[model samples]
Target chain A: MILATSLAIAAMFAAGAYLMLKRDLIRLIAGMILIGNAANLFIMASGLRRGAAPILPLDEPTADPLVQAMVLTAIVISFATAALALALVYRVYISHYSVDLSRLSAAEEQQAERDEPMTEDLRESVRDDTDGEASPDGRHAREAAIR
Target chain B: MIAVPIAVLWFGGFVLAVLDGTRKPAAWLSVAVLTSAILSTMALGITVYQDGPMSLAVGGWSLGVGITLRVDMLSIVFALLSQGVLLAALIYEVVNGVGARIYPAVVLFMGLGLTGLVFTGDAFNFYVFFEISMISAYVLVSYGESPRQFRAAFVFITVNLLGSVFFLIGISAIYHTTGFLDMYRIRDQMPLVQENPAILSATIIFVAFSIKLGLFPFHFWLPAVYTGTRPSVAAILSGALANIGTYGLIRFGADIFPRELRQAAPVLIALGTASIIYGAIQALSRHATNEVLAYSAIGQVGYILIALGIGGPAGYAAAVLYTVLNSTNKALLFLSGSLRGWLAGAAFAIGAFSVAGVPPASGFLGKMALFQVGIAEDRPMLVALIFLGGALSFVYMFQLYRRRTAEIEAHGSSPWGAQVVVVMLALVILGIGVWPDPLLNLVERAALSLPEAQVP
Candidate 1:
């Protein structure tokens, strides 16, 4: 039974990793959810194989209360996290009109061009003197040289 | 009595911060509350040092059943480092009128959670407190006006939440095997789980914490999040929040896992070495000021883990000292750029020197001790790695310093208050380095108190 559980978790982890590597932000969030569930199941299987509940009668010795409490807390916290992640995804979708991370990167590149002058000012101040006098040539030269 | 007062101060401050608008009054209130809490914590720490570890059971329950707050030298030292740097940050924010009440509230709750995390005896309670701390951190990371912050917070929250779930599952499994939640109880009961099922559970727990600590491959979220957040918030998180990961690893890794598993210590050392190199390389490659500092933090955390993996009196002391010194220096550097003018720029230079493990600062002393430990263990490779790590740190930090200082020289002067705080932190960093006997002694005492492990 433990072996089966372990295999299942491994499979889920692989799926999660594949999805996470994709360029879509929504898929990445889904991948995170899958990975979290796999870890949760793996944790549960690490204990004794006995299927009995953790609660104990007055006469009977109790199973580990600590483990039960931890699992419950973990479930709640994960739920909250999922909600927050989805909210963020909604914001991303609204702004970029697509959940693809690659598309978002393209948008950022355009934004960077618009913001370049301010950065140039900062670069001028940062280099101060040595390269400061060579600004138009040096800054553009550096950028062009890099490309 | 100490626990009650500190809790009231922290929780109360948190509440006030939430209710108050993003105004100067709220910032002042946060400063006032945290200052008092720091004073009270210092008194408690001195008392613990003079006496020994102090414990208080919530609701007067017996140990191993009810939540217990244990105050020892180790907890006190972390608390002192966290509270002291946070206080400085609060002052900076107040003076700058970056007076967002939510930020202070999140910081206070983070502090509260950390205090409880360090002091709590019950394992389940630790998880509860960790969530409280993390949720607040999530909000804080996204609280700034920048869009990049929103993206960074989303990624960070997702990764950490997954880790937390794994942590919970591991805790449950341990309980099922041993029927215990208290760390001391679990330590005593570890014999029952010494075989396959129990050992596997322990491994899961370690992996969960490793992710949180940003160990090696698990560290992707850290640099982006740290760079994206406001400088003041970044300071508190790097200075205080990240330390929780290492502290958790130590509390669980040393106490719960079987001794044989610890034989894998060299693997952790290797990972630490890798992180050190990777983070430094990234920092050197970055031009964004915060990005550079963020990567530097990653490298410093790697150094801490390496010390802990060594697992001896000297190793433990080195870890603790490194934690304190690194946290302080990092906080100073992170906040320096936000200061008003040129003086702030100078402060950044001094802070960068301290962080790069230069002489006449606590970072140097801590690295020296860590190097000595590696040599004593006859691990010449690890020793060389430590030296390489130090040199890498210098390259990146000096690059940042030189870049920023030039900018300041070109621009106007920074506000006087910002300059003063930066200079003060630098002086303190230097003082600790020159006369480290007192701090070293404190760490020694704390390390000795930990229950001895049966080394394989």
Candidate 2:
């Protein structure tokens, strides 16, 4: 039973790692879920294969109580992590129109236009070339350049 | 009596903060609760110093069945350090008006979890407290409401959850093999299960803890997650949460699985050395203010792993001291970043120096002890790697300092609150560096309580 469980966990880990490497954010979340499950199985397998229940018994010796307690803790932490990841996914969808990484990079480039300078020195250079009044602000210059 | 008051204060404060809804009252309530917690922990420390270790069993179930809270020199010392760092974080938040009611509640709960983590003897109870600490941490990290924060918290939660699962699996396996939950009882039956099943269980446990500690190969998520969080959260996570991993390792790895750990020491040491170099290189290459500190923490934790891998009283003491110093200094650095708008960059630099083990700081003192332990263990190569790591820290911290100071000079001072915290934290760091005897003695006494390993 332990051997079978270990193999199942190994398979889960392999699949999770593959998904984690994918560029899509959703896939990454899936990967995390898989990995978390795999780890849970691995920890559960640590106890010897055929042990009594961890609860104390009047007639029989109790199973290892420490592991049972630790498992309970692990479960609670894992649940919280899953909830947080879901919220992050929602954030990604709202910010980027699309959750695609490549498209998001393109959006950032478009936003870079706001940082360009429009000063008197640059306006003077533009005026000498075109013999036209400078817009005083970079907006006209950028509009003209974009056009 | 002391424990009851502290515990009640912590739980009550948490409840009150949740009920108050208003930010100010919750913040003040949290501050009052935490202040008292700190005082109580100090009182406990003094009592422990005078009376030695003390234990109180809940509901009279004796040692094995009922939950037990034990305060030895070690638990008290860690509690004190945690309290001090939390207080600093609280002050920074209060001064900066980052004082959401939830922030204070999360902190109070985090403190409660940490305190409970140190004292609880029941394995299940340990998990309960750990979750209490970590769930609050998840909230705290994402408290900034920024996209970056959301992303970071997501990653942090994912990785840590996986680690917790591994921890659970390991614990369950141990239960199946041993039929006993108590550490004292587990030790007695250890010799019976020293074969294949135990070895496998030990390996699973190691992986779980290694991930938690952010050891090499498993530390990929740490730098990014830490860099993205708020400086206060980052400080607490780097300083306090990270130490829990090492503390768990010491408790489970050394105490519960001694023979297995001894057999696995070389691999553990190798990983430690790799992390030292890896984290240092990553930190040195980073130009981001927070990333530098994040990487530095990774490297510092590596040093603790090395100390644990060495497995002796001296090594254990060094590990304990490293935990204390690293957490405090890291908190100081991260908190300073939040307080000073102009010094964010400089605070990172100073933090890098403190964490990387540079001279005239607690980090340096901690590293010196770790290196001494390495030398005594005859691992000259490990010692060299540690020094090399320290050098990398110096380079990165200086680079960060120069960059930030130039920026500050260019922009002028931004805020006084941040500057004040930075100055105060720097003084604490320096004081600990120059006069570490008192702290070192506490760590040494704490280390003595662990069952002695026959030095191989």
DockQ of each: 0.28, 0.26
lDDT at residue B155 of model 2 (Cα atoms)? 68
Considering the two chains of model 1, state its CAPRI-style docking category.
acceptable
Summarize candidate 2's per-residue lDDT along A32-124 as a digit string, tens digits: 778877766665665443357755444565554544455455655666677767776787677555666556445433432322223233244
Please tell me which predicted candidate would have the highest lDDT against the true structure.
Answer: 1
For model 2, the chain A TM-score is: 0.62
In candidate 1, the second chain superimposes onto the true chain B with a TM-score of 0.94
User: lDDT (0-100) at residue A91 of candidate 1?
Assistant: 72
lDDT by residue (B15-119, candidate 1, tens digit) is: 766576367777777777787778888888888888888988888888767777777877788777877887887777766666455777776777777777877
The best candidate by DockQ is: 1
Each prediction's TM-score against the native?
0.86, 0.83
Pick by TM-score: which candidate is best?
1
